[model samples]
Target: MSKLMIDSFRGFRSFELRCPGHVVLSGVPRAGRSDVISALARVLLPESRTSPTMSDLWQTTITAAATGDTEPGKDEESSDGQPPAAAQRLSSVEPRPYANVEVTLTDLDPELEQLFEGFLERCGPDGCAVAEDQALPGAPWCVRLAYRLVYDSDVEALEQFVYYPLASNPTAGKYTRVPASTRRVLPVVMLSAGRPLQLRAGSPLRRVIDELDPAAAAAAFDVLRSRVTHAAEELAGHDAVAQAVGVALASGGVGACLTDTPLDTAQVGFRADDGSAEALLKSLQPTVNLDAAGPLALASHGSTAAAMLGVAEAIMLATAPGAVILADDFGDQVDTANAEHLAARLRASAGQLWLSTRRPEVARAFDPEELVRLTRHGGERTWHRLKRPADRGRIRAMRQLHTQLLPALTSPAVAITEGPHDLVVYGTVDRQRLPGAAPLSAAGVRLVAAGTGQDGGIGEIPVVADLARSLGFRVIALIDRDKAEEQTIKQIEASCDVVVRLPSRTAIEGAVLAGVDIAKVRAASATLTAFLSQDPADGVPDVKVVEVVKRSLHKKSLHEPFLDALVEETKTPPPMIVDVLNHVAAAASPSYSGPAVIDIPPIPLPSAASPS
Candidate 1:
C-alpha cells in the first residue's frame, strides 16, 4: 500500500491519500484532481518529460516570495555595498516556500526494500494515518520518496529535486537526493490525455520498452545486422560503387582511412553496429485494424487512449509488475464501451492504480472507499476520503450513501437529514424563508435523508456527513435533537461544514410553530378547518392547533393550504430555520473561508405558539 501526502502543490494544500493497491482520483473538472495525479506520477515516472514552471508553485509559495520575509541565501549587494535588485530580493527570501508530494510505500517487497534500504524508515500503524480512527496497518519496511520544488534563494530560481523524505540517519542534517540511476529504475507508468500511448521516446510506453529485457530480442537484432553487413559488402564490390570509389580516391583529400582496407574488408560498409540495431528497435509503433480500414494508427483520440491501456497492462506483466500506474482525464476520448472496459480494468488492478476523470461513467466504476475527492475549501484544494464499509455505523447509513452516490459526486453541497420528511422540511424552509433565492439549490446543495434515529442507531447522519464531504460537497447534517446525541453530534461535526441541531429535541413542524405567533397558529387552524368543510372557528387550544398542523404536515389535501396559511400569517420564521438560512448563505457565497458550526442553543423551546 502507498499513502500520498501532497503539500502546497499546485492547488492542493494538505492531506494523505491511502493508495490501497487501486486508488482512484475523481472530482469535477478543475477541482484539482489531475494535479494530484500528476504529482504522484512525476515522482516515479521516467519518460514523463515535462518541466514544472514557477507557475506550478502553490499560490501561497509564490506569495511568500513576493512578501520578502528574509535576506537572500547568497548576498547580491554590489561591491559598493548597494542593495541587491528589488526582484532578486523578492525571490531570495530565506526559508523559501516550496511544493512537495510524497508517497509512503508500506510493506515493500523484498527487492525494493533492499534497493532502498538506505532510505528506509518505519511508519507505524498509528503514525501514518491522517485521522486516528482511520489509522491503517503500517509497514515494517517503508520507503518514502518525494518530488519537490524549492525556491533557490541563491540563484533566485525555483530548483527541482527528487529525494528520499528522510535522511540516512534521523539526526543527520543532510537528506539524500535519489541518484539518477535509482530514479531511472523506479517503476511507474503515468498516462495522460496530452500524451498519447505509443512506442515513441519520452512516452510511458517507450519507457516500458526501455526497461524490457533486451536479451529477448538480442539474437534477432544480431541476425538483422549480419544480413545488412553482408548486403553492404556485396554492394561495395559492385562495378558502380568501385568506379565511384576510384574516382574519389585519387582526388579525395581524406581517403587514407579506407585506402589500407583489404578486398575482404569492404572499403564502403553499411553501419551494422549494436547502437544502430538498438536505435532501429526503439523506433517502432503499433497499428490496429478495428474496422474495414487497414491497420492504421488509432484514428480517434479516445480509441488511442483506450488501446494504450493494453500496453500499460504489458508494463504490469513484463516491464514492472506492481508498477505505479496513473491516468489523467482517463476517459477523455474513450467511447462509452471502451471507457467502461478501461475503467473496470483500473478498478480491478492489484497494483497501484490512480486516475482522475470527470466522466460519470468512468467514475462510477470504483467504490466510495477508493475515491479521493478534491474540493476547494476557502480557495485551497482539500482531499476527503470516505470510510470503508466496515467502518460505518449502520447498514442503513451505507444504503443512504449508495442511493445518492452519483448526485453527491456532482452536487456542490449536500444536506443530510434524519428522514425523508426532514429532507422535504429543510428544502421547504429554505425556499419559503428565502423566497426566490432558494439558497440550498441556488448554492447547488442536494438534500438526502439519513433515515430516522429510531432504527437502532444514529442512522446516516455520520455516514452521509462523511460520504458527502468525501465527494467534495459541503455537508450540512440537519437532524432532530434525538438523532444528534453528544457522541454522534461530535463525529458529525468533524465531517460536516455546518452541523445544525434542531432547537432541543424539536421536530421540523414544532420548530416552525414555536416561532409563529399564537394568533397565527389558531388562525391557520380555522382557515384549514373551513377549507375542509368542517367547523370554521378561531382560538382553538394551542395543543389542538398543534395536532392540526402535524396531521396536515403530510396530508396532501390540507398540507399545502395549512403551510401556506402559516407562512402568510407568521411574520417571523423559526430561529433554527433562520440559522440554517444564514449558514447556507455563507457557504454559497464566493468568500466562504471555512465551516461555520451553527448550533441553535439547546434551550427550552416552546412546542407551539402559546403566549399573546
Candidate 2:
C-alpha cells in the first residue's frame, strides 16, 4: 500500500490523495477527477511511459516574484516573507516549466523495502541543476522536496530523478529509467472512462493481464474464456437467452465461438453466420446472440454486464494483495444494485481501490469518510476528505433526501439553518426584497434545514456545516445566538466558512421583530396591542414580540402574510438578512473582495409615547 502526493502535476497545483484503502473520488465534471487517477498511475508505473488523454503538455512554469532584500548569506524575503529562497529565486528567474510526480511508500514489507532501496541507489541526483546558493540552511531532511519525473523538452525525453531527503545533501538525482523490478512490486490497474467493454484482443482486460503476468497470459485468457463459455452454455438452457440462440440457429445460422487472431488468446463469445463451413473458423469478429434475428457484440447485451465482466477479470488478475485498482466513473453503466455489489467485491478483493464517479447512487455505496471531493478554483485544485465517525444513521437519512439536497453539493455556497421554519423565514425574506435574486437557489446558494440535535436541542448547524465543508462547498451556518452554546457556536464558526448569528440574541424571528417598525406590526396584525400589553412600556422583551408574531402567523404558514408584512413594513432589510445576501453575492462572484458591513441602526420599539 502507498499514498500518492502530487504537486503541480497536470491540472493539480498541490493535493495529497491517500490510497491507504478503498477510496471513491467524486466531483462535478471537468473538476480534475480523471486527472488525479492518471497522475497516480503515472507515478506508480513511471517506466510504462503512459500519458493522460489530454496531451496539452502537463507542465507548470515557475517564476520568482520580486522580494525584499535580506542579509547576503541569508535567504531572500518575499513580500509575504514566507516562501523559501529557492522558491523565491525560481519565481524571480525566467519561468522554468516542468511536471512532478511523487509516491510515498507505506506499510512496505521487507521485500518491497529492498526493491525501493535498489531503485533509490540506481537513481541518484546526477543531472539535476543544484541550487546550492538558494538552498535553506539547516532544513530538516524529511521536509525537503523530492522529484520523480522532470520533462526536458529540449532533449524530448522524460528525465527520471530521485531525491533522497534523508541524505546530508538534498538534490534531485537523475537515472536512466525506473527499475522494472521496482515497478513489479507495485501493480496498478486503471479502468479509464473511455475503456471499451467489448472483449477484443486489445481490450482493457487483456492489457491488465499482460502487464501483470505475461507468462500466464495464455492461461489467464483460457480461464476467462471458459467462464464465458460456461455462462453462455448455462444461459442456452434458460428462458430468454435459450430462445434467442435457438431461433438464430434454426434460421440457417451457424454457432461459432468468438476467437482472437492468435489462437492462443481466445475468449468466450458467440458468432452467427450463414450455414457456410468456411465462415466458422475464418470469422474475423465474434458477436454474441442477444436477439432471435442475428448476433451482436457482447456489449450489445448492455454496458452493465460487459463492464461487470471486465472489472471481474481485472480484479481476478490483480492477484497481488497490495495491488491497486483505479476505476474512473466506476458504476456509471450499472444499476444501483449491481453498482453496490461491484463496490463490495472491489473492497473485499484489493488492498487499495480508487474509484471516481458523479452518480449519487455510486457515491452512497461506500462510507462517507472514504469519499474524497476534488474541487477546482481558478488554476488550482484541492482535495477534501470527509471527517470520520460520520453518523451512518444521519447518512441514511440524507440518502433519502439525496435528490432534494443534491444541488447543495454543487452549489457555490450553502447555508445550513436550525430547522425548516428558519429556512422558510430567511428564504422568504430574501426572496421578497430581492425579487429574481433568490439566494437559496437562483444565486447558487443552497439553504439546508438540519433538524434538531440528538439530545432534542435546536443546534444541528455544526454537524451540517461539517458535512458541507467535507463535500467542498463554501458553508455558512445560520444559528440562533440564544439556542446555541458559546462553545458550540465557536466550533461551527471555525468549521464553516461563515457563521451569521441573528442580531436579537435569539432566533431569526426575534431579529425580524426587533428590526421591523412597531407601526408596521400594528398595521399587519390588528391584535398586536394585546401581546405587547403584558410587557413594560420602556422596553419590550424579544420573547414577548416573538410570541406575538408566532401566534399571528400560526394560522397561515410563516412564509405567507406575516413575512409579506415584515418585508413591506420594514424600511430596510434586517441585519441577518443583509449579511446572508452579502455572503451569497460574494460566493456567486468569481473574485470575492471581502465581507461588506451594513450598518443599519436597530429600529426603536415603541416606548411610553407609543401609538396605543
lDDT of 1 by residue, 385-420 (tens): 766666435354565554565545656677777666
Return the top candidate by TM-score.
1
- In candidate 2, the residue pairs with backbone N, CA or C atoms under 3 Å apart (3 or more residues apart, or in different chains) clash, namely 63-91, 64-90, 64-91, 64-92, 124-173, 125-172, 125-173, 126-174
State TM-scores per candidate: 0.57, 0.56
Q: In candidate 2, what are the lDDT values of residues 1-612, reduced to their tens digit?
A: 335666656666567655556788876556777877766666555443544222423544566554544556764555676765454454322212455555554444556656555333221122222344543563211112244555555766654444434352323443344544556456666665443433445455546656778878767556655665576566555666656655564454333333333221122234335423223323333466755946776656777767777677667756775767878777878887788787778777777788887666666667766777777666566677765554675574444234334435445567777776677777777766665444556656777776532322345566666666667777666766655677877677777776665544465555556545555554555433344443221244433544565454533344445656555666455555666566555644446555432222344443322544
Question: Can you tell me which runs of candidate 1 are displaced by over 4 Å?
Answer: 17-21, 28-31, 48-50, 61-96, 126-139, 168-173, 194-197, 201-213, 216-285, 300-321, 335-340, 389-393, 415-466, 470-472, 476-587, 590-612
Candidate 1, position 540, lDDT: 54
Query: How many clashes does the backbone of model 1 have?
Result: 2
Looking at model 1, residue 403 earns an lDDT score of: 59
Q: Rate the local accuracy (lDDT) of all candidates.
A: 0.62, 0.57
